[model samples]
Target: MHCLEVNDLVHRYRNGDVVLDGVTLRIPAGSIYGFLGPNGAGKTTTLRLILGLIALQHGAISIFGLQLAAHRIDILRRVGSLIESPSLYDHLTATENLALLQAVHRVDEAKIGDVLDLVGLAGTHRKKVGEFSLGMKQRLAIAVALLHEPELLILDEPTNGLDPNGIVEMRALLTRLNRERGLTIVISSHLLAEIERLATHVGIIHRGRVLFEGTLDELQRRRRTHVALATNDDERAIALLARQSIAATIADGRIVMPAMPNTAIAQVNRRLVDAGLDVHELHTAGDDLEAIFMNLVSN
Candidate 1:
C-alpha cells in the first residue's frame, strides 16, 4: 500500500503566484521517498498541504488509504513531521523538552528514555538544548516526532545547515528509523548526493512540476554514458565511426560518442587503428546525477 499519494495537486499563493502545478507522487510503504527540487519548487508547500498546515487548493492527498481532506485528524494522528527547522525550547533540557511534548501528545512518559536512546541522545538528559550541537538539536526534534509512535515521518531538509559529520549522523539515524522500526519516511531536499545515498525512491521536481519519479536504478538508466576518445586524426576517427553507423562528435579536440560495451569499444579502437589513425586516449564519461538533473530541469 502507498504510504502517501498525491494526485494532480495544484496550489498558489494569495497573490496568485502558482507554486505547485499538477504535481503527483506515490510513496510505497516502508520506503524512504526523497522529494527533490530546487528552492521555490513547491516541495515545502506540498508538505504543508499534506500536514494540513494550509488548506489544499486543488487535487487530492491521501495517507495510508485515508484522504487528507476527509480524514485530517486521523491522518495526522499517524504522521510525524519536522519541517524546515525543529522547534525546541533552548532553555529546557532534552528530557524536559520531550516531557513537554509528551504531555501535549499524551504519550507514555516512559518512552522518553527509549526515544532518547533511539536517536543517539541517550545520557544527555541534563544537557540543555541550547548546549547541544545542531545535529543533536535535530535529533531531539525527531525524538519529539517519534513520541507519538506515528507510522510515517515527513521531514523537510533534515540535513540542512548540518556539517559533514552531522549530515552523516542524520543519514544514519533516518536509515535506522526506516529499516529497524519499519517506519515509512518522506524527506525533501535539494541535496542530490544525500538523496542518492538514502532514498529508495526519488521524485525530481522543477518549477512546480514533477519531472521524474522512480527508483534510483530507473533514474540512473535514464542517464546515458558516453565514450570520449583522443586520437591523432579526429576527422578520420569521426568518419570511421560514422561508417559503422556510430554517431561521433568532436569536443575539446577529442572524438566523443555514445558509450558502448567493451567489445564495441574494442571494435572501434581496432577500426581506428586499421584506418591509420593513432588512438591516443580513450575513456568513458557521463552518468552523473547532477548532469541528469540539470538536463531534466532545463528541458
Candidate 2:
C-alpha cells in the first residue's frame, strides 16, 4: 500500500503564483522516496500541501488511504516532518526542546530519550541548543519529528548546510530508520547526488510538473545507452544484428547498438559468434542521475 498519495494537486499564492500545477505523487510504504527538483520546481510547495501547512487550493491528498481533508488529525498523528529551517529554541537543551513538543503530542516520557539517542543527541545532557553546531541543531529537529513515532517521515532539504561527515551521518540515520523501523520517508532535495545515493524510488518535478516517477532501477533502465561494438567485420555485424531485430549502425568505424541489458548483450554476443564473426571489443555507457535530472528539468 502507498504511504502517501497526491492526485492532480494545484496550488497558487495570493498573488497568483502557480507553485504547483496538477502535481501527483505516490510514495510506497517502506521506501526512501526522493522528491527531486531544482529550486522553484515546486518540491517544497508540494510537501507543504501534503503536510496541510497551507490550505489546499485544488486537488486531493491522502495518507494510508485516508483523505487528508477528512482525516487531518488522525493522519497527522502518524506523520513526522521537518520542513525548511527547523524551528528550535536556542535557550533550551536538546531534552528540553523535545519535551515541549512531547507535551503537545502527549507521548510517553521515555520517547524523549529514545529519539534523543536515535538522533545522537543523548550525550548532550545539559548543553543548550544555542551552542550546538548546525548539524546538532538539525538532528534535534529530526528528534522532535520522531517523538511521535510516526509511520511516515517527511524532510525538506534535510542536509542543506552540513559538512561531509554530517551529510553522511544524516544519510545513514535515514537509511537505518527505513530499514530497521520500516519508516516510509519522503525527502525533498535539489541535491541530485544525495538523492541518488539515498532514494530507492524517485519523483522528479520540473516547473510545477512531475516529469518522472518510478523505482530507482526503473529510472536507470530509462537511461539511454549506446553500445559501441568492434568486431572483425563491422559491416557484417551491423547487418547480422539488424536481421535479428536488433538495430545497429556503423559509427566511427564501429557498430553502434541501442540500449541493451547484460543479458541481451550476452545474447547478442552469442548470435554474432554463431554468425562466424569474431567480437573484439565492446563498450556501453548511459546517462547518470545528474544527466537524467538535467535533461528532465531542462525539457
Candidate 3:
C-alpha cells in the first residue's frame, strides 16, 4: 500500500478563497516526494489538510492505509512533521525541549538521544535552543519530530533559513533517514535546485492546483531539450543552429538550444562543421527545474 494517498482533495479559507482544488496524489513508502510551488500556491494548505491540522472541505486522505480523520491520533503518532518553522521554547535546552515533547507523546526518554544523534545534534543537547544557529534549530526540530521513530516525515520549506552548508547537512540527514530507517518523506520547497538534488518524485503546484506530478525522468522528458554549444566562433555556431530551425540563444558565452533529441544534436554538430565552424563543445544542459517551474507557472 502507498504510504500516503490523497484523492480529489479540496480546501478553502472561511472567505471562500479556494486553496486546493481537486488534487490527487500517492506517495509510496520510503520515497522522498518533493512538493514544489511558489508562495501562496496552497502547498502549505494541502500539507495541513493531510496532517489534519486543518479541516478537509472535500475528498479523502489516508496515511499508512488508515483514514486520517478516523485514525487521527494513531496516524499522527507514527508521523513526524516540521511545518513552516520549528517551534521550541527559547529558554529551554534542546534536550529539555525534546523531553517536554516526549512527555506529551509518552515516548521513551531513550529515544530522545537517539533522535538527536540522528540529526547531528548529540553534543549540543545541553545548549539553549535560543542559542542554536538556524541550521541547528532546524535539525533540532527534525530531531524532535523523529523522537517517536515515525514512519513518515513531512517538512514544509525545510531549508528556509539554512545557509549553504546547513542545507547540505539537512539533505544528508534526510538521505540517511530514508536509506537507513526506510522512512517516507514529503517535503515542500521553493528551492528547485535542492528538490532536483534530493527528490525521487515531484509534484508541482501552482495557483492552488497541481500542474505536474511524476518521477524526475518523466519531468525531464516533458522539458524541451536544451543544448549548450561552443564553437571556435560563437556567432558561427549560433548562425548554424538557427539555420537548422533550432531555437538558439546566447547565454554565458555559449549558444543554447532548447531541448532537442540526441539525433538533432548530431545534426547541429554536422551543420556547424559544414558551415566551417569548429565545434569546441556540444552537450545538453541538465533538465533545469527552475526553467520547468517557470514555464508551468507562467501559463
Candidate 4:
C-alpha cells in the first residue's frame, strides 16, 4: 500500500509564482523514495504542502490512507520531518535540546536517551549542540522528528553540505531507521549520486513537474548497455552482426553493438570465430545515471 499520495498538486503563490505545477506522486510503504530535481524544481514546495506548513492552493494529498486536508492533525501525528536545517540552541546539550521538545511532544523523558542512541549521539553527554558537527546536528534534528515516533520520515536535502564520511553515516542511519522502524522515508535532493545510493524508489521532478516516478530498478532498466568488442576483421564482424540482426559499428577500432543477453553474446563470439575473425575483447559498458538524468530533464 502507498503511504503517501499527491495528485495534480498545483500551488501558486499570491504573487503568481507557481512552485508546483500539476505534480503527482505515489510513495509505497516501507520504501525510501527519493524526490530528485534541480534546485528550484519544487521539491521543497511539495514537502511543505504535504507537511501543512502552507495551505494547498489546489489538488489533493493523502497520507496513510487519509486525506491530508481533512485529517491534517491526525496525519501529521504520524509523520516526522527535518526540512532545510536543524533548530538547536547553541548553548544547550543534545539532551537538553531534546528535553525542551519533549515537553511539547509530551513523550516520556526516558525516550530522550533512546532517541539519542538511535541517532548515535548518546555519548555527547553535556557537550553543547554548538560544538556538534554538522552531521551530528543533522542527526539530532532527525532525533527531534523521531521523538514523536512517526511512521513516516520526510527530509529535504538532509545530506546537503555533509562531508563524505557524514554522507555515509547518514545513509547507514537512514537505512537502519527504515529497516528497524518500518518507516516510509521520503527524501528530496538535487544530488543524483546521493539519491542513487539511498533510494529504493525514485521521483524526478523538474520545473514543478514530476518527469518520472518509479522504483529504482525500473529506472535502472532504462540504462543503455552496449556490448563492445575488439575484433581482428572489423568489416567482416560488422557484416556478421548485421546479418544476425545485432546492430554493430566500428568505433575507434572496436566493434560496438546493442545490448544482448549473455547467450546471444556467446553466440556472436562463436560466429565471429567461425567466420575466421579473431575476437580480442568483449565487455559491456553500462550507462552512467547522470547521462540518463540529463537526457530526461533536457527532453
Q: In order, what lDDT does every prediction score?
A: 0.90, 0.92, 0.88, 0.92
| Candidate closer to the true structure by lDDT (higher is better), 1 or 2 | 2
Per-residue CA lDDT of candidate 3, range 1-299, in tens? Answer: 58999989888788998889998888889899999999999899899999988988899999999999899999999999999989888899989999998998898899888888888889984679999988889999999889888999999999999999999999999999999999999999988999999999899988888899888777877666668998899876776667667778888898888877889888888888888888889998764668878988898
lDDT of 1 by residue, 1-299 (tens): 89899999899889998899999999999999999988888899989988999888899999999989999988888899899988899999999999998887888889989899988898896789999988898988989889899899999999988899989988998998899889999999999999999999999998899999998888888887899999998987888888899999998788889989989999889988988889999988876888788889899
Q: Is candidate 3 or candidate 4 better by lDDT?
A: 4
Model 4 Cα lDDT, one tens digit per residue, 1-299: 99999999998988999889999999999999999999999999999999999899899999999999899989988888999888789799999999998897789999999999988999999899999989899989999989989899999999877899989989999999899889999999999999999999999999999999999888888898899999887888898889988888887778889888999889999999999989899988877878778888998
Candidate no. 3 TM-score = 0.87
TM-scores, all candidates, are 0.91, 0.83, 0.87, 0.85
lDDT of 3 at 140: 91
Instruction: Show where candidate 3 strays beyond 4 Å.
Output: 226-287
Off by over 4 Å in 2: 227-282
lDDT of 2 by residue, 57-148 (tens): 89999999999999999999999999998889999999999999889899999999999999998999999999999999999999998999
Model 1: CA > 4 A from native: 232-246, 250-254, 261-263, 275-280, 283-286
**True-structure lDDT of candidate 3:** 0.88
By TM-score, the better pick of 1 and 4 is: 1
Whole-model lDDT for model 1 versus the true structure? 0.90
* Model 1, TM vs. native: 0.91
